[model samples]
Target: MKKSDVLEQIRKIGLVPVLRAESESQALALAGAIADGGVTCMEVTMTVPGALKVMARLAKERPEILLGAGTVLDAETAKECVGEGATFIVSPAFDEKTVSYCRAHEIAVLPGALTPTEVIRAWDAGADVVKIFPASAMGGAKYLKSLKAPLPNIEMIPTGGVSLATAHEFLDAGAYALGVGADLVDTKAIRGGHPETVTAHARKYMEIVKGFQAGCLI
Candidate 1:
């Protein structure tokens, strides 16, 4: 998909399920479960043993879903995932090379940032979206609300501490999107053969996103 189109989809969904799994099968299965719950976008972290292949397989098999590579620390890994059909790339920290490579490839890149300086630097480096990671430790939604005053146009996605209960607060605080991991896709539940649990969690989160988009939660 075109870069703008992919970003628009993300903005509309407002929640990106970040998955860390024991195996590619688990990741893909969890992805499918989330998809079944109406969330078609996901970030498969490189922490997974074969993350590149996992992204490739999901992109190929779940053509309707948008797949991205996460924990992408460098340009080479970013390029590899894109070559393998990842529609987007995300990193825990901002890297100029990684941002540049994704821009060069016309893929969406969300490089993690914590401070105002890092956020602007990532934006200046051509990040499609800035991920405010470890967000809770940094003050979560309230902190993000403060950033919007001066950086109104910069789209910020706060990850690492978002949950179904707090999803609406982030959206109300002006998060362009949210990156949720364990809270949305519990690794233990998946490992214990409870894909349904993850699916149900996804459904609730999407409901909040939908409500926010419709201005029902404000």
Candidate 2:
């Protein structure tokens, strides 16, 4: 997909599920469950065992899903993930070389940032979107709102504290999209043979996103 199109889908969907699993098989199962629940875009964190294998399989088997690589700390790792079919690169913190590489490759990059300075630095470094990592630590939606006030031109994806309970608040804070982890991914439920639990969570989040977007349209 074109870089522009990938970013458009992200904003349209308004939710990016962050996937992390203990095993490759479990990761696949979690991905399947999330897709079944109506979320087709996700960030597969490198922390998962056999992360490249998982990304390859997902890219080959599920062409409809938008796959991204997360926890990418360096350009080398980002290159490897892209080779495995990651359309986007996501890092927990800003790395100039990694961001530069993605930009040079025409791939979407969302590097994480927290403070105002880091956020600006990431944006200035050409990040398509700055991900506010561990957003809960800085007061969640309120913090995001503060960032958006002056940096309104910069897009941001708030991660680490988004839940069904707070997704709406994040959207209201002018977040470009949400980065949801355990709350929506639900690996435990998948391991317990309840993939439906994940699907249900996806449905709930989708409902929130769709509802918010619909309101915006009106």
Candidate 3:
């Protein structure tokens, strides 16, 4: 997908399920389940074993899904993930070199930032979006609201501590989108052969997103 289009889809869905699995096969199963639940976008964190292989398989087999890589730490790792078919890259810390490389390659990149300074720095370096990592630690949606006040032009995706209960709050706080893990991916559910749990969470979150965007909810 085109870089801009990828970003558009992300905001439209309003959720990116952060899939981190213990095994490649489990990761694929969980990702496939999420897609089946009607949310086709996911960030497969590099922490998963054989993550690149998982990305390659999904890219080739599930071309319709918007698959990306997460937990990318450096330029070299970012390059390798993109080569393996990651349409986007997410890092826990902002690395100018990686951000610049993604900008040059036309791949969407969401580099992590905690403070307003880091957020702007990443944006200036060409990040498509600044991921506020460990977001809840710094105050979750309330913190995001504070950042949005002055940095209204910058897009922020609040990761960590995002759940169905708080997804609406995040969007209401002006988050571009949310990078959700346990609440949506639910590792234990997947491990127990209950992908249904993942799907249920996706469906519920999607409904909330739709409601929020339509202004049907506060």
Candidate 4:
């Protein structure tokens, strides 16, 4: 898919589930559960065992769903993930090299930043979108709103503290999309043989995003 289309789909969907699993099977299970609930995009973090294998399999098995590689720290890892069919690359922190690589390769890159300085630097460096990591620690939606005050043109994905309760608030605060972790992915639910639990969470989140988007429609 074109890089522009990938980003547009992300904003249209308005939810990016961040997946962290114990094993490849668990990751696949989580993806299936999320997809079943109407969410087709996810970030498979490098922390999971066999992360590359998981991405590869998902890319091949679930071609309809958009796949991204998360916790990508450097250019080399980003390149490998792209090779494995990651259309987008997400990182917990900004890496100049990684941003450059993505730009050169025509891939969407979301590099994480916290303060205004870091966020602007990443935006100026050509990040497709800036991810506000650990957003809850700095004040969640309020902080995101503050950042949007001056940087209204920058597209941002708030990566932490997003949940069924706060998802609407984050969108109201100008989040282009949300980067959700345990709240939506639910590793315990999947690992404990309760994939349905994760599916339920996905449905609720999808509802939240859908409602918010519907309200925004004019």
lDDT of 2 at 191: 79
Per-residue lDDT of 101-181 in model 1, one digit per residue for the tens?
A: 888888899999999999999999999999999899978899999988899989999997899878888888999999998
The most accurate candidate by lDDT is 2
Q: Judge candidate 2 at residue 25 and give its lDDT.
A: 95
Candidate 3 lDDT over 50-70, as tens digits, reads: 999999999999887888899
Q: Per-residue lDDT for 79 in model 2?
A: 98
Return the TM-score for candidate 3, rounded to 2 decimals: 0.97
TM-score of each: 0.96, 0.99, 0.97, 0.99
Residue 55, candidate 1: alpha-carbon lDDT = 82
Assess the local accuracy of residue 35 in candidate 3 as a C-alpha lDDT between 0 and 100.
86
Error of 1 at 45 (Å): 0.5
Summarize candidate 2's per-residue lDDT along 1-218 as a digit string, tens digits: 99999999999888899999999999999999998888899989999999999999999998888999999999999999999999999999999999999999999999999999999999999999999998999999999999999999999999989999999999999999999999988878987999998999899999999999999999
Model 4 Cα shift for residue 38 (angstroms): 0.7
Q: What are the Cα lDDT values of the candidates?
A: 0.89, 0.95, 0.91, 0.94
Clashes of each: 0, 0, 0, 0
Q: Which whole-number lDDT from 0 to 100 does residue 194 have in model 1?
A: 92
**What is the lDDT, from 0 to 100, of the residue 147 in candidate 4?**
98
Among residues 3 or more apart in sequence or in different chains, the pairs in candidate 4 whose N, CA or C atoms overlap within 3 Å are none
Could you tell me which residue pairs clash in candidate 1?
A: none
